[model samples]
Target chain A: EAEVAQSPRYKITEKSQAVAFWCDPISGHATLYWYRQILGQGPELLVQFQDESVVDDSQLPKDRFSAERLKGVDSTLKIQPAELGDSAMYLCASSLDVGGMDEQYFGPGTRLTVT
Target chain B: AQSVSQHNHHVILSEAASLELGCNYSYGGTVNLFWYVQYPGQHLQLLLKYFSGDPLVKGIKGFEAEFIKSKFSFNLRKPSVQWSDTAEYFCAVSPTYNTDKLIFGTGTRLQVFP
Candidate 1:
């Protein structure tokens, strides 16, 4: 089975520091998503991408967060000057296309701990 | 804006017991509903989804859900559960045939005892 790959399964950073997480989606998937999962809460959408082009980012905190998928394959999400409340599990998911009932496959996620 | 709500925050059950988790969504238009499970140290995996034509949808591991449009509810159920079924379950909703953004419920943590 093709699985989504994520790097740095765990990260610990001081407040105001910068952190970056990487994700490589399943092969041939065209749509990718980034989500933030707070403790005891469900995942919230942060950004959506369609083959390297951003489809939606309304919920993304643009002031301190940014994501890119230059090649439409792997993606990177960065948080600059992280705050204590920014500690959460950052998850990445992908689907075959933007339509139909195709289910999104999620990565293991990078757990961030901001001090 | 769409939102999903799950009533139970935590549930405990013994092996061979029946299970049901409540999920409701607030969306006026057509929507797609889904249930996802996250095992310990694992990523979120789809349990099932409801699109169209069927009010009841069956998923992996003997899980099923009923989509009640009038009530805006999609409740998950299983006749018998095992210890391995212990995990965090989430309900999510997205506008029908629209974008890929999904709104998820808080989540229900199920602890099944052996």
Candidate 2:
């Protein structure tokens, strides 16, 4: 099974510091998604990418968070000046394409803790 | 805005007990429904999905769900559950059959005991 790969599975940083998470989806997937899951809430979409182009980022907090897939494969999500409220599990998901009919596969996720 | 509702916040079940989790989405047009599970410290995984055809769809681990168009709901069910089945369940929906975004519900936490 070609599962999604993610690095820095666990991270702990002080408030006002910078943190980054990386994700490499299954081979041949075209659509990628980044989501944030609060302690008690379900995952919420933060950004979506079709290849290297961002298709939707309506929910992304661009002021402090940024994401990019430079080569249309592996992706990076960064949060500069992280805040205490930003502590959560950052999940990366991907599908064959932007079509919603296809199933989305999720990575193990990066758990971030801001103190 | 499109939203998903999961009425059951938490459910506790013993071994061999039946299971049912409710999921409702507010979308009048065509929609795709799905159930995802998250075990403790595990990755979120697909349980089942409904795009079209038969309303009742079966998934891995003896789980099944029924998509009721009239009720705008998809409820997951299992004849019996095991202690290993304890996890959080989330219901998601896409406004259209093939859209770019997937909206998820708050989620329901299930705790199973032997």
Candidate 3:
């Protein structure tokens, strides 16, 4: 089965350091999503991309976080000067299109820990 | 902005036991509902989804969910569960008429004993 691929499954860094996560969605998927999951909580959308264009980033903390999918196939999410509270599971998901009924395949996630 | 609520945080069951997980969303517009499962160390996988149809939808692994429009709810259920069913389940909602961004609820972790 085609699955989303994520690198650096785990990351540990001190507060004020920078961290990055990477994701490669299944081929032919046009919609990509980045989410953060605090322990014991649901995943919250940070950004959404459609064919290399950002569709929604209302919840993204632009001051410290940034994401890009230049080719619309693979993506990268970065957090500069990470804070203690920024520790969470960074998840990547992708789907065929924007319809809500489309199945979004998720990656294994990169667990970030800031001490 | 929309939100999803899952009342159960954790559930423990033995093999052959029935299972039900509650999920509710606060949205006034047309919506799509889904149930996703995550086994330990595995990625999240869609179990079922309800777009528009007869409220009841059946999914893989003997799982099903009912969408109640009036209640703004979609509840997942399984008549007989096995030890392999131990995993975390998440309920999500998307406002079809508005945006396609998926809003998820605090997940429910199921620990099934053999």
Q: Number of the top candidate by DockQ?
A: 2
Better of 2 and 3 by DockQ: 2
Candidate 2, residues A23-90: lDDT per residue as tens digits?
A: 99999999999999998888999999999999999999999999999999999999998999999999
lDDT of 3 by residue, B14-100 (tens): 999999999999987889888999999899999998888899999999999999888988999999999999999999988887457
Q: Model 1 over residues B1-34: C-alpha lDDT tens digits?
A: 7889999999999999999999999998998889
DockQ versus reference, model 3? 0.77
Model 1, position B72, has a per-residue lDDT of 94
lDDT of 2 by residue, B63-99 (tens): 9999998899999999999999999999998877447
Taking the tens digit of each residue's C-alpha lDDT, what string does model 3 give over A23-115?
999999999999999999989999999989999999999999999999989999999989999999999999998755578899999999999
Best-first order by lDDT? 1, 2, 3
Candidate 1 positional error at B10, Å: 0.4
Per-residue alpha-carbon lDDT of model 1 for A8-106, expressed as tens digits? 999999999999999999999999999999998999999999999999899999999999999999999999989999999999999999873578999
Q: After superposition, how far is residue A49 of candidate 2 from its true place, in Å?
A: 0.8
Q: Clashing pairs in model 2?
A: none
User: For model 3, how big is the CA root-mean-square deviation?
Assistant: 1.1
